[model samples]
Target: MGHPMIQLDNLDLKLSLGRLVLNVLYIKSGFFYHSMPEHRHSNGSYELHYIPSGHGRLIATGREFPLSPGSLYMTGPGIDHEQITDPSDPMFEYCIFFEALPSGRNHHERLYGRSGGDSEDIREIARLFLETPFWIGQDSRQLQHVFEKLAWEINTRSIGYRRNITIQLEQIVIGLVRNYTNNQPTLQTAPLKTLDDKRMVLIENNILYNYKHITIRTLADQLGLSVRQTERAVHKQYGMSLREKLLEARLQEAARLLDTTLLTIGEISEQVGYQSSESFTSHFKKWQGLTPSAYRTRTIVPTIQ
Candidate 1:
């Protein structure tokens, strides 16, 4: 533990953490000997590709950019992109895909092994995705070192390797953000994101806090966006329809009421925006396969037993 570390240069990217959830999907390195076929990432996650050797061209959003060793670029959710190798020199790169968990704490804590020291580290990692711009061209040997470490950890599959790779990913993000912001590299790129972070956060907060009263018109008006625009943006960014998000919000609230309130099933349904108790019961059954009354009873019986 005595190994000294270099001080990370200070950089700023006005980040806010309403809720930070970063789930790294996979990390891999590849060497391409020929042109890559056009493909799109359909899974709706943030992506990064960094080339440490060779030369190529990256085609994204119908635009082509110079690609060479140490050039880092991004492809956002729902974006179609492709790469062309330099033919003789080909191209070798490291690619990573990360999805932001919408909600869920148990799954995250289970993966990263939060030994009390990793929470702050995890927040720093989340800042990377929140603030990082797409397509950086800086060639940082330091970053390359961290990426290679991840590649090795992933490839070898040692004990606790999952945790190892996760931790290293956080470090790599922190390092890259610090370096990129400080240097202010001239390469221009932005994730093909369709929603504003602040607005999206506000919408999610409003939905969670006021599920019973939130309406598409009121929510859209509050954001100064038309209803159609609001729906489109929500679907684009979250990969779920507005109807789905609202239903989830209502379902989440109904479950909470079932657990914490003595209100009758009908009253609880009304509280969560259902007009008729019967209608609420039907929806609740479909959503949870348990009537509101049954869910409440099930919860209470567990405690009593």
Candidate 2:
């Protein structure tokens, strides 16, 4: 709120990962003269800290890591950590608190409708972030610039600032993931032996990201696998038949739309790959124990003035 300190909260910023949304709880950029008390993030939340200048120390789950300019680290869900700033120089810190929310398809699709490698890349990067528990390293991606831009976007609230914030958030996530992975010695020492693993990830991303229009044959063709092979792979990976997999994807997205959007049932039906509202309602009722409209009504939170 004063010089050398800025805190932005309740900003309603979100980053999409097809079905999972990363909601930014708060962001702070300031000189840390006071120490951050020990705390833990539960329910699969995360906090990222970057020290652009000065000095500090992070005590995480009984392990101590010295912090200084360019120090970057992440504390994931259930990690006990605290930050103590060196009073002599007081660390200039950029901290982001965020949590992942798993919803259905419509919200993510509305936020990011793009397909192909871009979407898949975001998915993979997000996966790494979620899977990693803790990492401490120096900046290799010049993430300070991205944080500066994020702060500017929030302060100015200019045209397209929300979109800009989303992009910057994506960059921050990518930077963090890269920092985590690039610093890992095992990732290089034990490289994946085959392209098969990457291809499977691609196939899963394609189905999840393009569930509305993806077909087994088209997906197989795109991935250079025969239709039968694709079907077999899908069943093995998901333990579901091809038709079941598609149906599950469509329903999952439909459920997300019901919870997070005001789209009409018919509109949501089409968006999630149903040819007709009747068919959508029949499948949804069977899957969710309620009609589409009923599910929305049950899940939607009423806004208070």
> For residue 203, what is the lDDT in candidate 1?
67
Model 2 accuracy (lDDT, Cα): 0.71
> In model 1, what is the error at residue 134, expressed in angstroms?
2.5
- lDDT scores for all predictions? 0.61, 0.71
Off by over 4 Å in 2: 1-4, 105-119, 185-305
- Model 1 is weakest, by summed lDDT over 10 consecutive residues, at 1-10
Q: Write the per-residue lDDT of candidate 1 for residues 1-305, one digit (tens) a residue.
A: 01111211111112122245444555556777866544444233566787878888876664667888778776655455557788788778777655554333553443244444547655544544544434455656467878777767666769997677667877766666565556663343223343444465456556556666777788888878999988877777656876776776677667767765688887888887888989888888899899887887773422110
**Each candidate's TM vs. the true structure?**
0.46, 0.55
Alpha carbon deviation, residue 261, candidate 2 (Å): 52
Give the winner by TM-score. Answer: 2
lDDT of 2 by residue, 28-125 (tens): 88888777645444434567888889987887756778898899988875566667788898888888877666454554453344653347666666
